[model samples]
Target: MVKSVPAWLRILSVVFVALTALILLAPLIVVVGVSVSESQFIAFPPNGLSLRWYSQVLSSNAYLGAGWISIQIALMVTGFATLIGGAAAIAIHRRQLPFSDVLATVFLSPLVLPTIIYAIGMLMFWSSAFGPVSPVTLALSHTIIALPYVVRTTLAVLAESNPYLEEAARTMGANRLQRLWFVVVPQCIPGLAAGAFFAFNISFDEAVLSLFLRGPTLTTLPVQIYGQLEFSPDPSVAAVSTIMIALTIVLIFVIDRMLGLTKFASA
Candidate 1:
């Protein structure tokens, strides 16, 4: 029989778990609390509760426009990131590409570099050559950041799949494209879906690159929120933030349903 922990140790374990949970969840709790507050100014322990702010946000033209732009940019980033990253992962897994390690590192270097630094480089480069930054510039920058997540997740799923599946498919007279499409791609469905969601989230929530590349016409939701917060924020900002939080919760549930949270954590 498996041994059980002592009661004292179990109680201590519960305390540790509670502490860790508090540390991780405190900010989210605070943000949610503020979102529901009736006051104009933000506060953790809200004076009152009301839905007026949410109604105001829903009616705001500026917020709606920015949100539309953000969604479009995020969708584009997700598509490009998933396609590029998945292809790179497949090539790396097969060892068909030379200097795979170097290539992998190059692909993932964006994760290691500071976003601000990359933003500066992109801004200066665009300014020097392209003139002014545009929606295309924002999409490219977001794609670069999102690609690493796709690559890492794809590689994780590939690592766990049967090594002989591809070989077996080939032996059964499956052409290269047929084997890859039928056998390989199915196994990567969970990872690819997770990465696609990640790409969307990162691009939607991103601020640094957005700020650097922003024009009057190219402002994203995050950039718009940041602008308001830097001066003075109203309850509408809280409403917008609450919407983002809700979207994130929906995404988390979808990811958990498609692939266990542990699968994503491991990736």
Candidate 2:
């Protein structure tokens, strides 16, 4: 039988957990507080709570336009990242492709490489080939960075799956495509959903690549926020950030509902 924890050890565990949660959530709490401040400028203690900044963000055309652009790009990145990353994970897991190890490394290389280096290279290449940056450029660049998250998540689920399931399906007269569709795909659903959430979150919050690829006409929410902070930031910026935080929280809830977040805890 497992031994019960000592009282002191249990107390220590609770304290540690509380501290960890505080560290993780402090910035979000501060941002939410600042967003509600009545002060024209951002204030931490929030000089009298009010929704005026949120109202300002809603009325601002620039924020609305940037938000729309960000949403569109994030949706596109989610699709492309899920498809490409899921496929690459399957190939790597099965060891079907030549140099599966190398292929996995190649797919995950973006996570290791510096974003600024990739951004500079993409800018130069796009400048020479396409002439100017566009939404497509930004979407594709976000996909490149977000792909590794999908691949890693999918691979985690795939690794935990029954290895003999495919062979058993073949024994029951299932063809390659049928086995892949009915068997492999079902096993990957949880991972795919998790990865899609990650892709959307990454794409939406991504600032560095968006900044590097931004043209005169191209402005995402994060890029717009960066510009505001550089010039003159007010509570409106905090409000926008709070909204983004809310979006991320909603996505997290959705992922948990769809895939049981606890299922991936060990992963």
Candidate 3:
């Protein structure tokens, strides 16, 4: 039988949890605080609560253009990452390939590699091979980085699934496509959904690759925010950050309600 925790240990755990939450949430609190401040410049412990900065962000053409570009690239990255990573994970899990382990390692290598290193290397390579960086380049680069998350999450779900499901389907005379579509794909839905959200979030918030690949007309929202911070600081930056945080939270909430991310996470 599991023993109950002592009072002292429980109190200590509560305190530790509170401290960890504070540490993790402090920056977001400051950003939200600054976002609503009436002050022209960014300041936490806001002078007065206002939504003028948000209005400014909405009205600004530069912000809108950057936001649109970010959305487009993020969507493209999510689609590519989900499709390719999900298929790769399934193949790796089946061990049908000659070098399944090596293939898995190759697919996941980007996760361990330094983003700055990859960004620089990719930028140089693209410049030489393709001449000019485009939104397509950014989408592909983001897909490469985001692919590992999809592969990892999908693999986790598949690992927990019944190994005999495919064989059972085959015994029932289910064709290859029928087995995959009716059995395997259904099992992978939760993991694929979670990974898709992760991919979208990463691509939308990605700054390193965007910074390296940005052209005159191809700035993403993160790159624009960086430029603003470097040249001129304002509460508008905080407003943009708060909006991004809100959108991400909403997206996660929606997905969790639909697919129950707890299943993917538990796996």
Candidate 4:
């Protein structure tokens, strides 16, 4: 039988959990605090509270344009990553194809590689092959990075699901396409939802690829914020960061609602 925790040990455990929560939440709290600061500069434990920075961000053309661009690219990445990764995960789960392990690794290899390395490669490859970088290049690069997340999440969900599902479908006169559409896809829904959110998060926050592949007319929200931070940052940056954080939190809730957090925690 498992031993019961002593009272003092339990107290320490509570303290540890509280500390961990604080550590994880402190940075976001700081960002939100700074975003509401009345001061022009980014100062945590802000002097006073105001929404002036948020208003400034809303009124800024560059920020608005960059946000729109980021949204477009993230949506495209989500679509492409979900379709490709879902199909690839389905294929891998079957293990019908020869060298399935090798193929699985190939599909997930992008996740193992550093984003900076791929960013540089994509920039060089695109510049040399295509005339100049554009939103499409960024979208493709983001999709490449996001695809692995989708594949891994979908595969994780598939791995935990009933292995006999497809066979049962076959026994019920379901062909490959019907079995895939009905049983396999349904089982992977939780993983797909989690992975899609991750894809959108990555594409929205990605700066390395966006920076290197940035064209004269294309700028993502993260890239815009990076430029401002490198040159002249203010509470406006904090406001934008806070907005992104809010979006991420919303997606997290949505994912949790669609599929319990425990289901995709591994993913």
lDDT of 1 by residue, 1-267 (tens): 988999999999999999999999887787778878888788769779888888888899889999999999999999999999888888887777789899889989999999999999999999999999889999999999999999988988888999898999999999989998999999888778888999999999999999999999999999999999999887688789889989999999999998899857765
> Residue pairs in steric clash, candidate 2?
none
Q: By summed lDDT, which 10 consecutive residues of candidate 1 come out lowest?
A: 258-267
For each candidate in turn, give its C-alpha RMSD to the true structure in angstroms.
2.2, 2.5, 2.2, 2.2
Which stretches of candidate 3 lie above 4 Å from their native place?
1-10, 258-267
Candidate 1 positional error at 110, Å: 1.1
C-alpha root-mean-square deviation, candidate 2: 2.5
lDDT (Cα atoms) of all candidates against the true structure: 0.91, 0.94, 0.93, 0.91
Q: Write the per-residue lDDT of candidate 2 for residues 1-267, one digit (tens) a residue.
A: 998999999999999999999999999999999999998777898999899999999999999999999999999999999999998899999997789999999999999999999999999999999999999999999999999999999999899999999999999999989999999989999889899999999999999999999988799999999999999998999999999999988987898888777876566
lDDT of candidate 4 over 1-267, digit per residue (tens): 998989999999999999999999999999899999998777879988899998999999999999999999999999999989999998998899999999999998998999999998988898889879888899999999999899998988888899887888899999988998898899998778788899999999998899998977899999999999899999999999999999988988898898777655754
Query: Per-residue lDDT for 1-267 in model 3, tens only?
Result: 898998999999999999999999999999999999998777879999899999999999999999999999999999999999999899999998899999999999999999999999999999999899999999999999999999998998899899899999999999999999999999998789888999999999999999999999999999999999899979999999999999988988977797676764565
Better of 3 and 4 by lDDT: 3
Candidate 1 clash pair list: none
Off by over 4 Å in 2: 1-21, 262-266
